[model samples]
Target: MSIRRLMPGRAALRYGLIGPGTHAQENLLPALSVLDGARLTAVAARRPDAAAEAARRWGADLWTDDWTDLVDGEGTAEIDALIVAGSPQLHADVVPRALARGISVFVEKPPAPDTATLEKLAVDERGAPEGTVAFVGFNFPYGQSYRKLRDTLRAHGTVRTVDLRMVSAKPTSPVWGCATVTDSLLQGLGTHAVDLVLRELGGPDRVTARRADIGTDRHALHVLLEYADGRLATLLLGNYSNRLEYRCELVTDQSVVGVLDDFNTLTLSRPSRTPGVGVLDGKETLRHTWPGRRGGYGRTGYSTELESFHRSVLHGEPSDSPLSACLEVYRVLDEVRRQTGDRP
Candidate 1:
């Protein structure tokens, strides 16, 4: 079916959330509340008290401790979509359940604990009725800086090499990491970096990853993704950092674009062919300060991504982050785990 035909002329789409935790508290829930044509219908948490509290805080009509009841309930009547932000271990079950009932799923990173589980989830995804879609919450891809940067790179030409770094403080809770070393850090956070690289250079032909235990079970990561088209992306992950940091540098034949962490600024520099020592800046160079697209650090980007998802699901179009993208992410993460010996 064509995506344009599924659009509902004038009605708000309802969404349900499974595992409404800190991320939900800080980002998703707040974002959903303000979006037009989208409603927060239900929320489920690990504990009933937390679920009830989130439901109340987020204005969800229903709160439950059991995810099965929420996802398996009547089809899209109470909830048009499901967001699985729970632990990776639980996603394998929750996402499949949601899809079986013909509901759209927006699952957070890692997808599952291990390759086999992720494979099972992929298999289940195939069985989902056509038009059913799933998304992994790789928020960085939808960022204003990233979107503009990616578009610029694609329009100019192929990206030959990319150097990326992602650093975050040790998670507040170890449950997020679970049994695996640095559990979801490399999978959850790394997923974002991987997705960006793939989006910029398509899928890679080979991926190699290594993990080191700095102090918090997982500390450092060195990943190399080689694309068949000769583009390469190198990822560096660090958790034992003082403050959160994200940096991406894309070097192409035309120019070099660098985006600083927190979307603070973007610098585009192209060296001149002149025989002088070097060119610091040129007339063609563009220095774009932060807040170029949206007001703050991705405040509007998240809203835009969610709104796009709502429109896509309602219109039966390709989801903002489709199931195929989710599968590729899982495939890359699985290979990373296999190389790093970080299976859960």
Candidate 2:
């Protein structure tokens, strides 16, 4: 079945949300609420009370305990798009069915629990209706600071290396059906790092070296990616920090260095005319910071990602983070999982 295209000045694209958890409440729902191009038509969750509460809070037209109601039941007829903010396993299950019905989808990161399932999703996306989009929510690349860093690197010269570190004080408890804390950490946290690497440096020739400190309470993973031309990228991911943090550094062959701090600030330094001059003492340094009024959703890319997905559905534009693009990230993640023996 082909989806109905929105006529100019018609009603906003109707959206059905599945898995209205904390993440959805804090990020996706709030973002959707503010989008003029999207509407919350329905909400579904594992618990009826939660679903009802979310619908009421978010001003959705309907609520249901079974997610299938939004995908295959009466609610399906009312929705033009689906947002799956569930677990990786649930994302795997829900996305294919939604696409089969000609519904565009915006699924959260780590789209599936494993590479095999993600491959199937890629195939399903290819076979879906021509205009149907299967967008994955890897919002880090949409961050203001990171976007600036990409522009800075491109304008500077050939990129030589990229270093990214993401760490958070996430608990060891398995909240998403992952069997081990290490597995949870990799899927929950490390996928973001991997996706960032792929976006910045493309796929590496190979993962040259990897190290891990997997403990009962704290976990850390370090991966070194090497290119055929001697370029390099390093990923440092951990769940042992006192707070959530993201830091990225990029170096270009033109003696330009860019640093992004916590998705809010970007600093770029160009080589000075005089030799052996430090950036601190040089004149060619530039800094940009996200405005405080934009809020966390804008700084962290959630709002931009959600808005982009909505625009794609309304205008027949290609998804920025389509399922096909996500497969490469999963391939790299699969390799990391194998090397670290962090299978669930």
Candidate 3:
């Protein structure tokens, strides 16, 4: 009873979008042009003018200020899938409703404002119609550099340790109605870091250490994760930097080291010959860089994640970033909040 079988010979799947913000305009909307078997049929935003402008610019046939128009009103009947790129609060409100109607959803990262809301959303997702696909946008794992790193790690032996750092410029104010700058960072940016840890090494047994420097408009956090085994992972997340940077280094038991930089470059260092007693003994390096022209939408995995949602909706395939999978990551995030005394 696959969705594909149910809708025989449908040439293209229609999509409704909520939130025509900068992120959607710059990334998601542009991605629709290259997406096969799909088209943007409608768009809804908080402001009437924004919705109108987005529809005009992106070739969407319908536009409305009230998101309800897409969720349960006029636009709902026209769309097979809904893309939610608004605030986490909006996601909390819209995702469940869309699922109830059997509409597949692709929500941006930080799926909910808090872990409890995300947990509730998971319950709603489970109760959703048989073939509904609920996907969150943890796109880092889908990036080319991270994919290469995963392949390299698989070719090698067990990973002993992982070090991840994600930093970005300070925000002028709290994002998406988060209680504080620190809360916003942990929920928004830190989710990706935690998701990456879970992808590489399963859930950590405990959060060994947690520290944060909370400020009025900027924040920094350091967290250490220890597995039951000897494996370890550390995350340095912050929004007080001069620019955006993302890097991850993985060390394996087979004397292999792989580094993924900024979701575009991967560098691996391995022993070229039998290890000598010296520290810098015979070793060679291999580097792979994504083409600069491919653009961030593809290079950073926005397109890939969207396409995954498309396939899951059309073919009834399980989503790669389902809400259930996010529970563990949020468990770690909840622990971080408790340890750091961050509210909301």
Candidate 4:
């Protein structure tokens, strides 16, 4: 059943905002305004002053500096759900509080800073109200291109191999202001890339990563994930490139599919004849384009993801992104970092 049928529509889903920071103010709040069936009831920041300022500027009904005020105080009941955008450290403390109070949560990525906190969240979620959903915002998963890829793979057959590459200029300002580009790159971009890889390949049994220190706060990483079934996927990620580049190629026995330019493009190619193995020549290529709407931070995809979680919470339906799926990704990150000797 559609999540809408199971819960009160957007209007019924009372939403709140925690951590009224740049991303929340710039992306999430504006996105929430346009998403159907979701309401922005309040906002809370680490500082009461900041929360009050955001509330005044953003039209939120209530504002508090204390996160507990939103989860345990009068404002707590005002919101049936919250989008937790606090720093990575705050997640370990605040997310469980919201869940303990029966409020549904949609956390920003790197849901927690490290493995220990993520593990605790897994346990806390079990005691949450049945059907109370928690989500980690790997917004790319909800992209039209990926949805098509998932659908296509299911309709066609299993993929034999996948190659995904993403290289971009090092993050600027606050992204780099906190940590070296290398540490932040893997934690930030790697999380998104790795999550998508796991989603596409199911899971990787063996993961070996090689890293090169290109510069401060930036490193080039080559990650190879091997599945027990012999399926393999590779990820090339680094903050050293000058241009903004992102693309993924999925190969099946029958056809090769490409998600290019960060899902901005999708192409399909079939070989002229079934070659025994190896790459096909340029002559054996066909392409297909799937046009989709695009706008806003993250292409209006964040709104779609938020709306999905809001509905899931109200109707008592399973979340599109349940905590288990989130935990899987965390486990992957834990394993990868362990192998790479990367710690945050």
Candidate 5:
């Protein structure tokens, strides 16, 4: 059944904002402006001045320095949900509080800085009423190109190999919520790729970790995941690259699918018969162009993801999908740390 049938078509899901910082301002708010399923009800930042200005700018009805006020529902709008866009510590605190109140939550990635906190969230969520939405923002695979690429890989036989490469430029200013990642770079940036790899091919049986120092405060990582079924994936990540670079490659016995240029391109390759066939006969070459990739950040499934969560809440659909997936990402990060003994 289409879950949209459960919601009033005209009613928007009202959601408050906690930790209204740069991410909220740039990504979430801009995306919300173009989507109709959700609307901003309030915004809360660590500083009252910042919150007040943000509320004015974002069109929220109220603003506060203390996020708990929204959780308490005192002098605030009767919100149906909240988008927790702050650091890991704030997410650990507000997410549970909001959920315990039966308010749905949309928290940014690295849901918690540690496994213990995630386990606690699991406990809290179990006690909440069924259909209470809990979503984690791992927004990569949601991109149209990536989605198409993932779906295409499903029919290409068993996955033999997978590669994820991402190199990000250093931040020019403080990135909100970054301070809370256990190992900020890997947890923050690497989470998306980790989540995607596991989602596409099922869980790995075992993984070996590796890394090399590239520069001051910069490093390159190599983690190899081996599945019992003989599937393997290599995650290549680095922050030293001054320019942006992101790509994902999935290879099967008969096909090779690539998500390149930070999702700007999707290239497919498959076996082709060679002309001089004396029995040696074929080579895999670039073949198809999967056509759903969008042009910019706003178009790249950010709004679509928000709309999805809002619709799920109003329609009583299972948002539990992201919750468990999010935990698996943490598990991957945890295992990498265990294997490499890199404590951040």
Candidate 6:
């Protein structure tokens, strides 16, 4: 559905934002403004200046440096949901309280600083109010190229192997190469890779990995994931790259496909079939490459994800980024850290 379809109603989804970082400023606020059915009711940030500035910019009714002013029911807006885009370490402290107050929440990935906190949250979310939904932000699965990749893999039979590669520079990399408190790359940024694998191939039976600290924070790493049926997947990540790059390749019985960059391109390869002879079937492969749309073709990943959360809160629909799913992603990251001997 288009953003216009969700406009101006008594049932509008009112929101209170808990962080005013670059992500919230550049993406979420703009996206939410377009989500006409959702109203920005309050703003809270660690800095008083940031909070007041966001409030003035959005015309929100309330602004505070303390998030409790929003979730504690002492704030001005009668919000139906809370968006927690604060530090990853604060999710454990913030999410549970939001749920307890019967307020739905949308949090960024790595839902907690560690597995122990996430485990408790998994339980808390399960018992939250009837319509309260909690979501984890892993937007790649919502991208157009990723969706096409998943569909192409389905038609080609089971995925036999996958190679996921991502590289980026320091200071600007997503999650900054690695998390300092937890699984580092395995959880902070690698959770997207893990979540993609889980959605397409179910859970892995075995996981192993190695980390390389090349000046950057464990700047490079290699990961191996083994499935119960003997399928294998590999992940490689680096933070010392001169520029940002992302590439993914999946191999199945009948075809191979690659999704590159921020999922803007798809490259497919399949065995060639000759009319008279089967000689070219295994010897040669036919390849096709096409550019995939990011935001123009329809709802972008960020828009769709926000719409998903809006629908859940307004219509009682289920969220794909539920606490359970977030926990599952964390579990894989926990395993990766354990295997690699990452410190808590």
Question: All models: lDDT?
Answer: 0.73, 0.85, 0.85, 0.74, 0.72, 0.73
* Per-model TM-score on C-alpha atoms: 0.84, 0.91, 0.92, 0.85, 0.86, 0.85
Which pairs clash in the backbone of model 4? 6-315, 7-315, 10-37, 48-65, 180-217, 181-217, 182-217, 182-218
Better of 2 and 6 by lDDT: 2
Candidate 5 lDDT over 1-344, as tens digits, reads 55564553533777788887777787878887666766676888889999999889877788888888899858344578889987777788987788878888988886887777888887777777777888887677676667777676666666688888877765422343444222567766777778878877777788777777665567777888888878899888777778868787887765444444466667665655422222222453433443443444433657767877887898989873456666777787788876656554
Q: Write the per-residue lDDT of candidate 3 for residues 1-344, one digit (tens) a residue.
A: 65564553543799999999988988888887679888888999988999999999988889999998898897888898999999999999999999999888999988988778999999999999999999998888887668778886676777889999999885546778877677778876789999989988999987954665556666778999998888999999888788889999998887778898888788877675643223423565778888878666777887888888888888899998999899999889888888888756
* lDDT of candidate 3 at residue 156, scale 0 to 100: 74
Per-residue lDDT of candidate 6, residues 1-344 (tens digit): 65566454663878999998888887788778778588898999999999999999987888899988887758724788988887676777889989987889998776877668788898999889898899987777776567777775675667788888876664333352344522555565577778877776777888888877776343677888898787888888766678757787887755544444555666565555522233225445433334443353222366667888888888897877887876666777777777767655
lDDT of 3 at 14: 92
Q: In angstroms, give how far residue 59 of model 6 lies from its true place.
A: 3.4
Off by over 4 Å in 2: 1-10, 274-284
TM-score of 6: 0.85
Per-residue error for 234 in candidate 6, Å, reads 0.9
Q: What is the lDDT of residue 44 in candidate 1?
A: 77
Give lDDT for model 5: 0.72
lDDT (10s digit) by residue, model 1, range 1-344? 66575554533677888888887788777777777788787887879999899988877789888777777654346887888887787888888887887888888776776667777777777788877777767677777777667776554455689898988876534555465545557665677788878777778899988877776454788999997777789998877778778888887756555554566667766666522223334545666666544544353266667767777787878766755566676678778877887665
- Once model 1 is optimally superposed onto the true structure by TM-score, how far is the C-alpha of residue 145 displaced, in angstroms? 1.6
**lDDT for model 1:** 0.73
| Model 3 residue 158 CA deviation in Å | 2.7
